[model samples]
Target: MSLENHAEFKLSITKALGDQLAAALKKLAPAPLAMENIRALRPLPGVYQLYKNGHLVYVGKADRSLPQRIEKHFRKISGRRNISLDQMAFTCLYVDEDFGAVAPERLLINEHRGQGQVPWNYNGFGNNDPGKRRDTTEVDEGHFDHDHPIDLEYRLTKLPSQCMEAGEALPLSQLLQETKTHLPYVFRYQASKEFDDIAVEFPDAETTADEALKTIAARLPDKWQITALPGYLIMYPKIEDYPSARRYYRSTGVVDVW
Candidate 1:
């Protein structure tokens, strides 16, 4: 096996220490899967996701504590706990973590479920979709399973004037753009950290702490959406909802939405 595989193989031996693992594991955990271009902004608000293959397994919000949130997922991955996704690749995506507070994280969870992007839970959600009506047609777009990437230029803030006033059936792109601009500071903080890596730098402890809060404040608008989606990185919004969106996600036994 290659050196990386060998290391994980060696570490698996310590799995026997289940009872004492949590605490010890925390200190011994490896650094998170760092992102590319993670030095664009000051520490601020954002959302993050952990993906296996192109599918999302977990989503989280960072309210100025991007590193800490990222670390949480890394520690979970490193622990001896059972994890069995089809692909093991891991990468992170960030938006405004405020998305967490505004909407239910489960919304993102449901989005992925609707897309058939995430693997079915062990309870057999995947196999149980008998009618096949509940299944999402696998699309050709890459990472759509997790991030649902769209044209970045599609501005969400400048909603059609009449539609904005009436709150009519506005397009998803308009909604997103509005949300992004309404919370520019938040998105800026988010994009900055992922693209810039603010957490790894900054010498003053107080300054670092302040920047973290600024990030959180900047991202409040998007945090509402993250609250809806749960653990998905949110490349963008989905065009259609899954037929079994509610059933699959609601039945998955998720706890309170964060």
Candidate 2:
């Protein structure tokens, strides 16, 4: 014969704190993630939550200033398509620097892990750039960039320093390198002697990436093509099938080598 008593009390320290933080954040009203709204925020360390259309989607922390960190996100989202800045909102809690060693953002993420909120925390939304090596890699169909690729439309505002004004001719290679540096997203290309020697005149200020690529491609020698991959772009001197390519801009001289 056997007799037993079963009793249990289980709690994780981080999860407990996370639960309380989540509860408190939800109770506070959310404001637009716009600069005007965040401009009023004090430059102090804190944790924050981002919402899309009133639905929680991301959690973050700033060991320095909450305003600066949130502003970075604001500029990034403003350049993308399929999402309106009007749909983004945020809520924040100013925490003592002493409390940050606990990593409040991680704790908050732990609490919401299985709940389907804060999806941006794990998705590529938090990534600034996946880097050049990942350029050839195929993006998962569910990745954030796959759903909302860079808005090449009316997005090429930063011109190369060599050409201060529109309609100025810039060496094709300089244009490629300068654009890669200026764009909020990645722009990768191959190097060649022709790109260095040839100069292409760009269009007006409102010109889009498509227009720019077409201008560049039109000036290139035979067989050159510029392809837009899901997360970035790659330019080469031949037609090639990339599983991740969404669009391709072919050189005007592709039919016959110059």
Best by TM-score: 2
Give a tens-digit lDDT track for model 2, residues 1-258.
Answer: 876778688878877788888898879899988788899999999999999999889999999999999987887777677888899999999988998988999989887877888988877887876765676677886687877776666367767543457566778888777666666566767789778889888777766777777777788788777777665667777787676777777874322210
> Model 2, stretches more than 4 Å misplaced?
1-11, 158-167, 190-196, 220-225, 236-239, 253-258
Q: In candidate 2, how many Å is residue 158 off?
A: 4.5
Error of 2 at 17 (Å): 2.4
**Model 2 lDDT, residue 109, Cα:** 89
Quote model 1's TM-score: 0.27
How high is the lDDT of residue 70 in model 2? 93
Off by over 4 Å in 1: 1-42, 81-100, 119-258
- Rate residue 82 of model 1 by lDDT: 35
Compose the digit string of candidate 1's lDDT tens values, residues 70-123. Answer: 544342233211343223333333445544454323444444465564443322
TM-scores, all candidates, are 0.27, 0.77
- The worst-scoring run of ten residues by lDDT in candidate 1 lies at 243-252
